[model samples]
Target: METLPKEQLLNSLEHLVDGHLQQAIRHFQNMTAHDLLQPAYNGGWSIAQCLDHLNSYGHYYLPKIQQGIAKNIHLPPKDTFKSSWLGAYFIKMMDPETGKKKYKAFKGHIPAPDLDAYAVVAEFIQQQENLLIYLKEARSTDLNAIRIPISIARFITLKLGDVFQFVIAHNERHIRQAMRNVTDINKRILH
Candidate 1:
């Protein structure tokens, strides 16, 4: 896929971030504690757990992106961002449309079974807001030059633009997972 122009990329990402925020808030508004905590199937994560997983990622990436933008605030904005080959590959892998590819969660990022649903949902909403801010902040920097270390290996890094793309795509993947969990639970209840 071709890289988007900087303004276009940021605009698209903002729309995605805001849409997810609204959808998640609306979805969780009606969910009871029991509904939120119940797993989709035996041994599977609940909607809350899936969101908590996304929250864990947000916790890591949001700060790194923020710091990169702040440190590079003096740099002039660029018209375009050329994602690194590896960065592009990672973003593609994270895209939900690529089909489901099971990836093991990093040990530290895994959600505990006993998570409070309301709190987890609230945190996810907050993280999405933060992501929106970072996307706006990123417009002023050369996205390709600002590097953020991957959570898997601090030694490995990707450009800020790629990191934003990965994070947004990853969120979409899990939001769909969480929504599916909710649908499954509702179906089982109906049956």
Candidate 2:
């Protein structure tokens, strides 16, 4: 189990969330429907589809984290957090930079091709704002003691800190993909 100061972990996660929120506002704000739905150069998911996929995961995770926090609010905050082996594995796999392997998303998490670009982007931005609030609330709770069930397998659970890391890493991974799609659309227009 990897151990780190609790504040350090929360701060890093907040930084990632802030970056995502900023990127969404900057890159996705004024995009036309055609640009958002435009597929990547490699024929992968479009920018809107990418956010939609993330929104699906957010719908499952954010509430789980919130509930875990509320349930454990009585416990005194711990100074440090230890990542469970399983949680570490999941976070590593979800990280965009270190995890290069691709796996198919679960069917329920897949985004439809006909999504309204504005609504998807708007939802993603709202989710990010909600995540920031959760992160702040988490500071008063015991990060290591609270457990949250994974969305794919509710029977399994991870430390709250680990869940935060995994969820944010997953968001970062797809947000990067969305940005790549934006680049592809720009290049197509230039040529």
Candidate 3:
């Protein structure tokens, strides 16, 4: 994997997070509870489920990342980040564009069937807000030096930069899934 400028990587991740914020507010927030609960044409997860699933990950990762950032705050931020082979693999797997492969959600991350739509969306928005703050704080620390533990594989920890990339890409994948559910629902209504 090629080395990336730390600023560039942060900017890219921030842009993705901003898009997610817009999507949640403009699209998901406006959706009706029933619509959010409706499954996609492929019988996949509903919009609320998608957000809830992401929220689960956010709950697990945000604190860990925060701790990592805090521990490494004394270290001056580096100019570039070299992706670990494992980190690169996880990021590629999470990317929606490159990773089309489906995997079952960890039992802990699987969202419950009956969820409060408004509550789920609200939590997702808050998580995005937290992510923005973390990204900014991370600028003061060495992204490649700090390590964050993964929720799925606790034994393996990835570089802070890699975690950010992986988590945001994962969020993008599910956000697209949620949007597709909405679009498919609209098509059905039109028909």
Candidate 4:
């Protein structure tokens, strides 16, 4: 098995986490004031709402990870995956090693929460910042050795390393959603 070198894992995760954050920030930076508030779709979430929803996963679930870490107990994991064409595409896009770890998508699309766009963007940034800090301060050995609190049915024993990967990937998943919101809004404005 090709295990990730300590340096590579650290570098990749740092870059991955920060890069997606930058992507999300830059996406909104160019938006006009009107573009920022556009609904994600007719009768659907606004671009802002979409960010909040996408970010809420981290905000909601990361604390579980902290609780698990603090208590040294396993958390009942919630899958934040979707089953749309985009979800399927990202699954296929993952590196084979990562493909082995993530939870499978549910049969239907996961719904984005309805909320103000500013709230969504703010929460997303907060979650990303928190995760980066947690990961940055923890040791590679701790990450590679900690027993993750995962589900019983999944039959996968997750290491801190695995958990680290999941957090990073999960962040990326939402960043993609945030990006979609931006794209959708821009398309609407141009049309």
What lDDT does each candidate get? 0.88, 0.92, 0.94, 0.55
Instruction: Return model 2's CA RMSD, one decimal.
Output: 0.8
State every prediction's TM-score relative to the real structure. Answer: 0.94, 0.98, 0.97, 0.63
**Can you write out model 1's per-residue Cα lDDT over 62-151, one digit (the tens) per residue?**
889989999998888888988888888998888999836888888988899898899999999999988888898888899878999999
Which is superior by TM-score, 3 or 4? 3
Position 100, candidate 4: lDDT: 45
- Candidate 1 has an lDDT of 0.88
Model 2, total clashes: 0
How well does candidate 3 match the true structure in TM-score terms?
Answer: 0.97
Which whole-number lDDT from 0 to 100 does residue 93 have in model 2? 94
Give the distance in Å from residue 108's predicted Cα in candidate 4 to where it truly belongs: 14
Per-residue CA lDDT of candidate 2, range 109-160, in tens?
Answer: 9998888999999999999999999999999999889999898889999999
- Output the lDDT of residue 31, model 4: 62
lDDT of 4 by residue, 35-63 (tens): 65665564555566545544545654467
Flag regions of model 1 displaced more than 4 Å. none
| Rank ordering of all candidates by lDDT, starting from the highest | 3, 2, 1, 4
What stretches of model 2 exceed 4 Å from their correct place? none
Ranking by TM-score: 2, 3, 1, 4
